[model samples]
Target: MIAGHGPLRRLKDGTAELHQEAELHVRILDADATLTDYRRYLAAMFGYHAPLEDALAGHEGLRRAGFDPARRRKSPLLVADLRALGEDPGALPPCVAVPPVTTLPRALGVAYVLEGATLGGRYILAKLPPQLAPLRGRATAFLAGYGAQTGACWRAFAAVVERVLVTPEAEAEAVAGARETFARLIDWLAAQTRAAGAALREAS
Candidate 1:
């Protein structure tokens, strides 16, 4: 159901429950989500992605595996979206509890989560309600993600995983990275959301 075959399918299948649980945390796609809700979601995500990407930088294995980390950099896009929505990306706290990406296979595993998000981002953008519709071209670059290139980008990433992770050991490490990425993101968002809610209540 997660699509793809070989390592790609393995990664997706392994992390399926964690993926579903993350959606429960990311309420932006809900029918009642408001503009504020969307803003909060992007802000929380920036907090997660900024540090994760920073840690992921300089990992030569990603390049050797045929995927340039630079091409898939997501923090810049998140920053743009946050700026458009009137938030200062610089002031936001980045997640310190990031997944370990010290190895090539582990990095690819971490990447699997980030790259897969683009596919889900399209679905959210398409089904977004009118309340969340105004973000379209301006504040949704993070979600808009490669626009028409998302499919090809994901396919390319999947291929890289398949080709690079030919051994069972490498695939296992990738799965570990994927699971850890999901776990860290879910925890970070949960914490950020609680803090945001408390600040809002205090303001009122």
Candidate 2:
């Protein structure tokens, strides 16, 4: 199953155990990608790889602790294809912010960075459920943050995700850290979202 369109979900049942472990191994493989091209692809979609690997490791740790999320099988062909694409000399730039930039080239950059991927890779790894669904604070944060700082929306988005998914006791810390890291951008995005709302009402 698809996890709200961002990544593939693991299948449960007889396939769960093996498939779950397979994804972990694949994740580790990507985490250790030796190619510069792969690293660049990672940077484009996600802000950085180290944090992403951390997040993935966290989830794997959770699973080891007996969390029962669905399992996803790895495809060798898919991995080879990704490896090949990463190695391609003419591969596109990873990702670009949308709406704020809105340039055709930049928009295309976003698409290229996200294209042909079944999973969020590092991007979704740093995320919580709300970022991908239920339209939480992250969306609010993104429009509020924008260009003032790069990847602010993503950071707030990830934080809000952690808040909702993590226990309430930890929510404030998560939000605060996210706010600190992506401060300028998240503030701008929030402002933009508000402005857009006002514009929509004026048009109406």
Candidate 3:
């Protein structure tokens, strides 16, 4: 149980390294990446988010914290992106398991990882090639999920997390959940990248 100044701060500080590693694996930052790169990235996102969102669905902790599971789902956007890119949703690989969220503190921790990605998506969206403009709204919906309301949505989530994680022990649990989620995402992305590379080699 690592203690910190605040729950959110602790989660961020604790997961900073894992966050950076995940960002490095994200395709949006690759300058030489092509449309194919984006497609694979979206597919990977779909694989990672679909299962996690399912687990979070109708979670009592989320509802009590004023977090609507429906609006927060990113898998649909990932699916739409895959479709817009001419990929079959059914062909995508299965998502990895997410950390269990039986408690409010743990739920908030997992939600934190998902919601926080929206903020980073803003940056990813901006760096997208000009040729990708047409897909911005449709294929890139996951990145631009909240649009201008992104900041507001994050603030609202933060408020709920703060309310739910009142004690030090609760905060530690939240941080642990967040860390586990981040690690899982990193592993999933690495596996996706490896699979993509193997496929490319087979094609060549």
Which candidate comes out best when scored by lDDT?
Answer: 1
Off by over 4 Å in 1: 1-3
Least accurate stretch of 10 residues (summed lDDT) in model 2?
A: 5-14
Candidate that would win on TM-score? 1
Q: Tens digits of per-residue lDDT for model 3 on 47-74?
A: 8888888888869668867998767898
User: What is candidate 2's CA lDDT for residue 57?
Assistant: 33
Instruction: Flag regions of model 2 displaced more than 4 Å.
Output: 1-43, 55-61, 64-82, 86-168, 177-204
TM-score computed on alpha carbons, candidate 3: 0.92
| Residues 47-154 of candidate 1: C-alpha lDDT, one tens digit per residue | 888877876777887887789887788889999999987899999888889998888999999999998999899898888888888779888899888889888898
Q: What is the lDDT ranking, best to worst?
A: 1, 3, 2
Candidate 1 lDDT: 0.87
Cα misplacement distance, residue 200 of candidate 1 (Å): 2.7
> In candidate 2, how many Å is residue 166 off?
7.7
Evaluate residue 175 in candidate 2 and report its C-alpha lDDT on the 0 to 100 scale: 31
